[model samples]
Target: MRVTVLLAAAAVVVTAPRWLPARVVALRRKVFEKVNGDNVITFPNAAVGPDRFQEVYSHPAANGRSRGAGLSDLFWYWLSPGPEVHQEHLEAGPRYDDVARTTRALLSGPADALSAAAARCAARVLDETVTGRVTLVRLRDLMMPVWAEYFYELVFGEPCPREARDLIVGHADDVVSALKCTGLRHPARRARLTRYLARRVAAGDVRHPLPATLTPTEQVHYLQGTFYNTGVVQMSDAMAHLLLALAQHPDVAARLADDPADDRYFTRVLDETMRLYPLFGIAHRITTAEIELDERTTLPEGSVLCFSYPDYHASGHARPDVFDPERWEHTPVRESHHIPFGVAANRPCPAWRLSPLALRAATGEVLRRFTLHSTVAHTRSLPNRGACLLVRVGEPLPPRRLARIGALLRVRDRWEHVWRSVVQLVLGTVMVLHARRLRLAGRYFDPRPTAGCRVDQPPSSQENTA
Candidate 1:
């Protein structure tokens, strides 16, 4: 009967998404509200992506060498068409400007911005088709220069910190220069590299804001573009945490064999886990345009700083020393309380509803099919504001192994029919044992966000990687 029930449960997990309900989107947003970002109600940002990238390729002067117009091209994870975006900008010429301007009007900022973005986008596209590798150094070179020359100087419009400027520019350059070409063999690593660089560029300092004349909608869209990599990286980190968590839980076999989302098991895990670790948490921006934070920090045009997320989430610590989630049970649910995603209004997390729901389905699959027992207690840390996790798994072992174990196999023929019941008993006991372990050991802990990043780290750093 237990085996029959397990089989049935597995079937349910596979079919649940079609039945997950549309209202789940609202639920997702609500959770994002509680643990993802700042609760400020604002319009959506980041509306201009595809067109923004297309502009540079449009002009004869806009050759694919350096990104001439748009800064948004770094967002694309895929390959581009040229050696450099600048080459395309030159090739594109006036036609480039016309199309770029048109795109910018819709996307945010100015047409020139879109054109620049498009040129970079084209360069990437062309480079991929030609060299089949991305120019990581170029990405950093472009972004850092923009921030240093334009973003810092213009937005700051005051005495900027020479140290901060040096740190940001130098580190960006280091990251880019450190990049080496990886060929077809290391496709996965290449993709990871792409994401890492893109995140840095997207989340890195901006050289300037949209001209004061732009509408609110345009401003929001531009901010959205700025956070592209931030969102992507966060999602990636969260997923890594979930995978590690599954490795620690032994009964993952049953969950994998039969998905848990069907039975609300995955849902429960997702709710707790997402709260604990958010991937895209925290944000920082220049207050040049003039906004409010509080009494301690006032209006300084280009002061580089960030909103705290790790500290906010961990605020309910058991003690100054011990980190415990149980303590947070008493803590009221609040918007800025966590923020593994950004806290700002316009830059609200786009994948808020998307991530948890996906987590449920994906995690449910993982738990049902594998026997992931934690041999070690994995401790998450963000020394560099990114997830560098280490853990071990016992592998395809567990209740399923019972049927494969010779000793556990029932006797054959007539005897087999009689002993089959005994085999069943053995299997059930093993499943229960695995289940118990998963519950007792916090091996299945989710990735929670934390505050604090070194001068070399991004502000929203966390083991809370998506």
Candidate 2:
């Protein structure tokens, strides 16, 4: 009986992130509707049932006292109740935090340097994918080191500190220690880079914000954000999906390969690719107060709200799922309904401009060299299932090795299933008992606008709709 109870509890805990908050969100909606009467903006299919798929909407007040989830704040692990493994796959932790900080720093610190670094990294990634027996995930894995080196080089310059080198090359075991090295080096390096940028600004060479303006700690944080949290995962996912889409549509691939200089085609391809397979596909928020949505609907304080294109895109676009770049030909690119980088209103991705250009160049390079073949049919889930959509450059892995790999993959899947079930039962009970507290904690970040981003809303006129 005790064992059965434990199992039951785990099941509830595992499922709590979805059902519990959803129940509260629903109950609060009804209560508010009764009290306020008919003004509450009714969310279509807001309640996420056991099928675990539903459409939800959030209305972020364009005024003060409301806040949106930051890039660091929004995540599946934080939003959903699942095993730690779900988040682990997304790299949603301290390591991710470090990477996010770095990426952000690179964005605002040095534009030219950042773009150059990204270009070099793209070239390297393209070279590897063209030559090696590569899959989307494997190519991305190989590109990580190249990106790290270029990033550090742009920041710290050649003959990078031994500690920094050790960290990037994976020689260092402790990520914290590696970060510490960057933490210490950043202050002095930032000062120097700042002075250089100032000179460039004086000469009218630079247009973006100076990294020197940020304190050493802030600079380091921003730099970490750039590579780990933003660029590596999102860009990689976009590239993978683009390759898959191209593989499936050889006609498009041939046309794109023919015109490397045609910027329009490149932009359309990249935009459509991002629309279809956004890596950070979901936008999440936690309500700070009772959000009044047109006087009829109000979201309760501390409520978790989420939006994904897959769920909500149909309201604005016709045949949203069909991979058609021509749809974007007539429509605006930055429509609020289309949030590839993020919801444009509250939390737009800092690397939005850079991500596309880098990806387009990479795509062009890849198409220029080899004809890609899709080994897998579809993408797995959010934060992209890189393993699911397999690709081969030339020859497949040898039969013996392929069998061993296949066996290992099956074993891993089984273990994950068992682990998820066990964890759900164990954690689900705790979650049930403290469901309210969990929802309150699920907000991810405080209720304040993220710094260093435009305050303007997307063309759809939603404030930080992500």
Candidate 3:
């Protein structure tokens, strides 16, 4: 018994750090369930698997009942969930009038609705996702400006103002550094992110960014930098989807292990991979102007609008209703109708290029190298589903190789470290200026015009659960 206990302890000592993050383990319970009968909290959202995903985004075809009437709906409500908004159902107006006439003139065909919609969605994607080419050829001249344009739009909107553009371009490392400088002490996430980004791009896993420079202290700040929100997004979706994908197609792990950058096949695998487990449940927007939707319902200026991504992915019932990766292999090109990035023209996720690529690299590496097989295969919705599969990964590789990998990783990791130090320096400055502001607990001031006003102002109700 003593020897057995010692062996088990030795195994644990040899393994722990390689396969898990402290937060993943801390939130593991919410990520999975022992006896999930009804609703369970996943990630501040109650995902009744995909059903919850569907309900929030679209009307149930049978009765036009909205899924917003569920526990999962509570998440956004908690964040200003009320002002219950509805879709702009032109049925309330002359259904066959202006919109139809306007659409017809451009496409000139009854079936052109599909084409027109596709074009509109394409234009929006171009505005939102595309920037200038930043390749080996374009890196020296085109890259900084390209990223500046994108970052500018990402900031307060509208090309980041000409004055600020200079700061962004000249202070590339400084900007990444500023984010790292938060020092909130969560494993220097940004610093790690830079290293991770470099590895994936170098390995041809995804597109690459321009090179950057920074000092050691700056790197530390970058690691601790502000991730904004996508860090939460990535964690939630990966936890849920990883389990589902493994369970549905047991061999995928092996294939990814053999080659992590098999983009053609693996991309498809993760295509529906995102569908089965989306990073978000739903996104909320308040109606900007009052207009009649479906005629029967009139939204005052304060109405809340929401669109659920999970629902759309989940709703195609016959189309791999379960967590099946093969379905993604043949998954058709989806439009606004099935968006996980949100239905609005503006998507809040900024590091999209890097994020998905990072997720892919991580998933491929872990699945191939470690083998994450959970006895359980489930989802809740709170964390991503409320519950995910509980994985049991293999121990890390041996010391000699480990030492070598660590050294190389460290040298390559300098970019992240330097970037973070610069960010921390900036954050330190911000802190000194607002030392009194920091005195406030939990709530940070937004200084924006409508800082305190209740947004998505619907008639107040008890906070919705999910």
The better candidate by TM-score, 1 or 3, is 3
lDDT values for all models: 0.32, 0.44, 0.36
Worst 10 residues of 2 by lDDT: 457-466
Candidate 2 regions off by >4 Å? 1-105, 108-116, 125-139, 157-222, 334-336, 380-466
Model 3, range 199-275, lDDT digits (tens) per residue? 43345431222112322322222211212122222332353465446543658766666776577767666666666
What TM-score does structure 2 among the candidates reach?
A: 0.53
lDDT tens readout by residue for model 2, 284-381? 44554576544665467655454455554444667867777778778887553555665444545766766665666566656655655443333423
Alpha carbon lDDT at 275, candidate 3: 68
The C-alpha stretches of model 3 lying farther than 4 A from their native spots are: 1-229, 236-240, 317-320, 335-337, 380-466
Question: Candidate 1 — which residues are off by over 4 angstroms?
Answer: 1-233, 249-259, 262-268, 280-282, 290-297, 317-332, 375-466
Q: Is candidate 1 or candidate 2 better by TM-score?
A: 2
TM-score of each: 0.34, 0.53, 0.38
Looking at candidate 3, what is the lDDT of residue 460?
Answer: 24
Q: Which one wins on lDDT?
A: 2
